[model samples]
Target: MNSAANAHLINSESYVQKPFTLPNGIVIKNRLLKSAMSEALGTIDNVPTMKLATLYRRWAKGGVGLCVTGNVMIDARAIGEPGNVVLENDKHMSKLKLWAKAGTCNNTQLWMQINHPGKQVPKGLNKNSVAPSAIGFGPALTKFFEIPRELTENEILDIITRFATTASLAKEAGFTGVQIHGAHGYLVSQFLSPNHNQRTDQWGGSLENRMRFVREVYRSIREKVGEDFPIGIKLNSADFQKGGFTEEESIEVIKTLTDDGMALIEISGGTYESPVMALGSNIKESTYTREAYFLKFADTIRQETTASGLKIPLAVTGGFRTTTGMADALAHDNLDMVGIARPLAVDPDYPHKVLSGQAKTNPIRAISTGIKFVDDAALMEVAWYTRQLHRMGVGKNPKPNEGAISSLVKTLLTSGYKTFRTRRLRA
Candidate 1:
């Protein structure tokens, strides 16, 4: 074994040795969690494919304590992306169990992230998306998405029930938990954002009214799954876009969840309008350039909440890829867990590499700098190569030569009309 691997096995004490206990008493052995990343690997009918199972099995063996599946749409009409896994009925229970087994190979906890795309729905996928209000996603980015219809009061209630039903399915599928995708300007987030939820009904107008949907969803899940089942939420600390969900509103929402017995709260920010990809524009840049992306905001939330005597486990993710940096944030910043996304997508065994001393720090800079965000054609090519690396138990990194094959693979993967390709194609 290499020195790094040897060290990981021999070292009794390490920086990442800390564990986080969830509300249901489920304990995560380490702080590292694989944040949800959309792989677009599901079947056209929104079922889990063999390739999707293979992709997760590789990540399961990578050593992260927790792995959250990409957006599992609660409403079939409200799909986040074209190929997102949909979990609206019991028909997928067996397949989901298989997926759960593959994802939990290393005793790692696997959580399904439930979401509704709302007005952020891409035009090509669902031209008639739904939101709390008829407000568009601003004039600049309206071209990226279609005009969304405002959901009726009954429809909102039905959607909330759908979230609970999905959570129940997750429990039956043997998933460790379910994470409500309340961040990134999704359906739940649309209600949270003042800009998007401009309604005169009971579901809008004030922060409490806006938060009613999420609160009901959370409560319904608790009722269905029982008190001991873990239920997590990913929330935007702030929208970053003007006239949107602000830090003040976010803090209030956090407090409400804490009071209601949330298992964990993962803090993130940004929307389609002020996308986090706009380099150096928001606090995410501060995480890379300054350190602890939500350090200031988190501190304020923590101090005030602590002063008020509320103790909820808080997690922060975005631009985190260093052992020293993560350790510092956990120790000094009062954070309970750290979430990592793209890095693990590239290297599934990154957590093991870090723990075993094979790698001193997360290789975020190299991988992220190599990421070339381009048009759909370019992105498809990149996704193809990424799928290959994921199956081989290797992390994705931008390699120039892989682009040609990736381009071909992307077309094959996205062509919904094609029959299921054999697993050999993935290998």
Candidate 2:
């Protein structure tokens, strides 16, 4: 542990395998937190399916301290991707219970990641997306999304209420916690970015205004869930784009979350345009060499949290692939927990493997297709990984050696394509 970076070193015991207690009195069984990944496992009508339960059941038995489910939309009409589960009402209580039961088995804490896509909603699935301003994604993503309309004040308040309603329902279900999805260019993230949110209203313009949406969303959730239930957030260290959300703004937001009694804040970066969360970039050397996509920012955040004597737990996700890096980061108090997503997709038990020293190295790799279109779209990455998840959901082992190009073609030509089209065709 380095004293210069952090005043205290994580104890010698493998912090990854120890229990982590949040400020809210919710104690996670371990430091290995399974960060959110868009599962694409719901029915066309936005109900959680048994397949989703089966997949989560596997992860629960794998011994992760916390498992954050994919983006469950607050409104059915504003989904971020195909097959996203929606908690807009109570009609799906049975389905929610079924999914939550399996996910939280064996003492694993399951938290639903609630979100609204805003303009990130795909083109064919939506008529007109709503945002802080009438801005569309840049030209590269123009064809994939529609130009968004600026949200009215009433509509903005309605969305905030929806978030609270959804969080209340999540608590009613078997979920132990709920995480507000304020990153990855989702609605809250869009409002936080000055580049996307250009409104002159109270919800936009200055840094305080731009962050208002997220603050309100958190306050709403906290109102419903109370003090004991854990409320966390997955936020970006920076948007990693020119004139986008900066590290300084992000640190301020972290401080705000801490003040608001946040249980945890998972650090990640990039939006659709930057995609640094998935592909990464050269701007931060620690992201690659140190194996924490947001460690550089995580260190600064650690210093901030320590200086303020805030107890809110911080985590770094995205680039983690080895135990050594995880240990080092944890030792220096750069982060309190380790977040791994893609690696767990292929091997649900990777956490156990790392803990037991059975796996010597990280096997996670970048997805690619020989053709330009599939590779450039980044949908290939999602489709390729979906294959592995489907395998796990169906009680089969993941085929990590499966060809990416073949997987894309099969998804487009087979049941995966049908399932996707079924959801989109209805919209």
Candidate 3:
């Protein structure tokens, strides 16, 4: 309750409460990290707003050691959603600085997750989408997304520069660090997926070439941000799609990044096409019951990294639901941090509850619209959670028990309207 009492609680002997120092010498006060969740709280012009500051300040005070903001687009023309913040330059530096300050309050480490949506952009949201190769999605997704144009070599180089520019601006705005959104079927992930990247150039065709984009992006950012600023990445253990990014390739990428001096590596799985990150589909049944869908894979990577003598801090996101599960994973040395996303949307102070031993299990549950079509679409859950984030942006508490169908309808209407507005502006 009080500062002294809270400090004592945080300094407890529990594994979850223990502070850990990153290789960059930055110390996170505890092991709890609020993983990136698309807040969609930016302004229509794709600029940071005070609502972001308000929402993150709440999470900062609620007690997360590290809070990673949702994907901030590196390029305005390649936005994944309508309200995503685009950090192309310093035009909105003042607002960005405000958000950074609020999010980094109470000794929290706020990292901005930078991304480019590639062909994942919703239809009509962007005039055109680009990827490593000119390819279209499979039948189910084809109606929602068009075949993206293959990025020219010059365009690819420009994008690498854009990633660096965004990271530089984030550091200048006072964000403690930046995480490459190299997971989740975004641009970086698309480059790594053989199913998506069919290019025959130096940037594709082989595992080394496929991963060249991410390696270059990381190097560019590190060059701009300098050695002291922490730079991490959220990578997929496997894309869970046939001929997609594989576990073996993911491990190789991890080793390469480690060799390049990555400060942290957060493991995740799935893409928009497979969408297995939250559902735990195809993961081992034993790991599912433990509440960490990727723990088995994480442990394997942990062993590999230990054997290779890579000292990069590792984290795993998705399916972390209980305090016991979070603590036990750390006690077993599976990961250095616990990445919680949707749970914090419902209860912002969840980390404090977990640390104080007042909360054993997380309150998150499967959200369903009850309508088969709506429930089948993975956007339903994200929309429901986004509504909670919008509530928080307005200084209100999240409605954890909110009806799923109502949220679905609201999201559909809102998304349709935003898409129309975005298209009109482009026109």
Candidate 4:
């Protein structure tokens, strides 16, 4: 932490430690939310292990108001990564209950983040990838991801049903709430982007048509979980790619979701092709001073919704690195909660430190492998942080100064073996 930056740090005890209630009446004990991280800590069969319980219990006791789990795949056949926990039925009900109970300790709210990867699945990881259109990635990303086939209307309906089933099971397993992984260029984000969804049916062409899939998914889940349970979304403020999901379109989607009774809307940006969500490569220098890369768009949406008499809770989750940045965002009264992700990977008790006024700045640094292409892809950073998560899963403290290149190489080899096993099982 820089001493100059520390000079600007303010006491966060009043703002970040305050409790907030959702529209559905669920109370979050504080404003610090542990945003979802892709903790690939599951069995070879994609079952939730006790390690997840242990890891989340640490976060629960860390004093975060809400803890959203990593992406849990809805279908076993369409996995985005090697070790995603699939929640299709009650066969793993006991394991799910254990994870929920452990994570919901200290009166914390544990929400399950449900996702479908669609064409974002790595090449050969699944039997075949499916999306709204039979489109592939741009030249740079084509080497890693395969071209997906267009999904049929029946297949689309089946996926909607799958989302509902997963949400219903999560509620039964005792999770406090659920959130749709509608950001980071996943299945839901692909449907919302014109650059990805080039279909001509009722599910594409116009923005309304493109958003119909997410609207249906939300409706189905709400019907299954009832109005009292909170159902939120992690949405992209903009895709940051040409002809992609823009800020204006995102605002319209937010308005529609607000009208549709959504509980919260977390703001993030970029895709696998752009990968700006974590890197903040395209952000302005002025925005960097604010510490949150997407604050401009978040402020704009807050004003837009306030004018329309909608009080939707908003959280923005990238490039936040200091107590001053977090407190300033809340002091403006535009953001309801401060979303923290990578910091928690290194220090699970970061929330307690911030709330107790013991820490002024976060201990986060740029993660790079010194290789241009590897660093540009943001692979080294994810690999390094995921290694920290694994350390915590096994009851060890995180090594914040771990070597990035080593973590990248180790993760690549492990992912290669897992992909081979997945292909063999599918065959």
Best by TM-score: 4
lDDT of 3 by residue, 94-194 (tens): 99999999999999999999999999988878889999999988888998998999999999999999999999999999999999999989999999999
Runs off by more than 4 Å, candidate 3? 1-13, 280-289
Over 4 Å off in model 4, which ranges? 1-10, 280-287
Q: Which stretches of candidate 2 lie over 4 Å from their true place?
A: 2-13, 280-287, 372-377, 414-427
The number of the candidate with the highest lDDT is 4
- The per-residue C-alpha lDDT of model 2 at residue 132 equals 89
| Candidate 4: count of backbone clashes, pairs at least 3 residues apart or interchain | 0
Q: What's the TM-score of every candidate structure? A: 0.85, 0.93, 0.95, 0.96
- Candidate 1 lDDT over 1-427, as tens digits, reads 3444344334422656667788678899888878887766776667777666777788888888888888898977667665678888999778888888888888888999999888887665654788998878777777768778889999998999999999999999889898999998888999998888999888999999999999999998999999988899999988898788999999999999878888889888877776552222122443465354665677778888888878778887766666666666665545777787766755667888866656664454321223344332223433543454444433233333344444554655654333233112222
Predictions: Cα RMSD each: 6.3, 3.0, 4.3, 3.2
**lDDT of prediction 1:** 0.74
Worst 10 residues of 1 by lDDT: 418-427
Steric clash pairs (candidate 2): none
lDDT of 2 at 134: 95
- Measured with C-alpha atoms, the lDDT of residue 138 in candidate 4 is 96
